[model samples]
Target: MAQPLQPAEPPKARAFEAIVDHIERQVLSGELNPGEHLPGERELVTAFQVSRSSVREAMRVLESNGMIASRPGDPRGAVILAPTSGPLQKVISRLAQASASSLADLLIYRMTLESSANSLAATRRTEADLLQLEKAMARMRAARAQGQEAFSKADLDFHDVVANASGHALLRISAEAVRDSIEQLIAASIEQSPDDHALMQRTIDHHDQVFQAIRDQDAHLAEHLARSSLFEYYGHLLAKDEQIALSALASFGSNTR
Candidate 1:
């Protein structure tokens, strides 16, 4: 017996998404550039052959992703924004807060990414890059007497400098996202440590060693020091098995570099 063929399901309606994709392609293709103004909503609606609502929705999505900025009462439509890691930071931070497992994963990912960034920074850093690193270290040292909050900010700044020195956009963005995701956890750990001053001093000393390795252009040492510092600071938070796995990966990254 031949059964009647089932009717195929209709495709999903995603007009706004299509519009968003079109704009993104244009921007990526360099047809639209940062600081350039997008066409007015009506123009986009006509060009995309979609409704005004669809065009508006697409613009909102783009704005949320840091791709464009819209001001109220501006007849010039939205301004194209230079891409930034802000959206990545927000997404990573949200995911890390979603579960203990996610936080653990974030830490492992950061260890790998940061070690690579340190290695690259060591090999590629310029005089300006070294100066930035030194300034960040100075801030860390100065903040030691102030308290954990100040020190933590300086520590983050130092890592930012190291990531920037790598001159890899993806690495810099990923490092920033991971750092933001774990920042609160790091601060809480510092606050709960029995000897805050000792911990702070240890951090400053670790930074100094990493700074020296970068200055001397010792890629392997810089990578090893960065990984070791991270593991030393955060190993207590991980389960025994996870800690062992992360340590192994850190060794692999340092050795392979």
Candidate 2:
């Protein structure tokens, strides 16, 4: 006769995760800083009361998050990294592509993020921020004669400056990720336009108006112009329902501002 079946065991938390959590707390609390080396593996094993393998696993996690780096054949521990949005942006763009997110979805998200960023920049931007914006605008103007690709890059740079001026790190990172992910779409839109010259001029004029509004510290006008510019450029690509929704947003911006 067979013995009674055993119950399935519940999954246990990995020992490495505890080490990861401890080190993450240290970094968050300012105990660890960029360019500083982590304690050696032996020290981490002793401190976390875990095996060497667990300590190694913890290091791997931190490295993947761009929080630390290690050199091969070096006895020194992993170096703490200055935080950057690069890893976050890569992950977001990858997920969007993997999930087959649509161009319309990307545009809608951009419109929302940029409009908010413009509004925030109107109030929070410093003189240096305004200088950056003007520099980007100047670059765009200079790039116009260089062709569509150059103009597009400068155009993106301008948006990046505006996003950075919003005084919100999350907004800046998200906007940059979304914009980078849609480079092909933007290029296609330019290539497919009936009149490339007209399109380029419209883009420059829109940026000029939005920048002026931001410089003037007119939050409502800045937001309205930002949203309107996006709608004007990408509205035709959107579904009828989306166009209707965005139109309502533009109307709201006009009345509210």
TM-score of each: 0.85, 0.79
The C-alpha stretches of model 2 lying farther than 4 A from their native spots are 1-12, 73-75, 90-102, 184-191, 194-197
- Model 1 bad stretches (over 4 Å): 1-13, 93-100, 184-191, 251-257
Relative to the true structure, how large is the alpha-carbon lDDT of every model? 0.86, 0.83
lDDT of 2 at 12: 69
Candidate 2 lDDT over 173-240, as tens digits, reads 77877777766455565447787777888899999988998999999988888778877777777678
Q: How many clashes does each candidate structure show, in the order listed?
A: 0, 0
Residue pairs with backbone atoms closer than 3 Å in model 1 (clashes): none
Q: Whole-model lDDT, candidate 1? A: 0.86
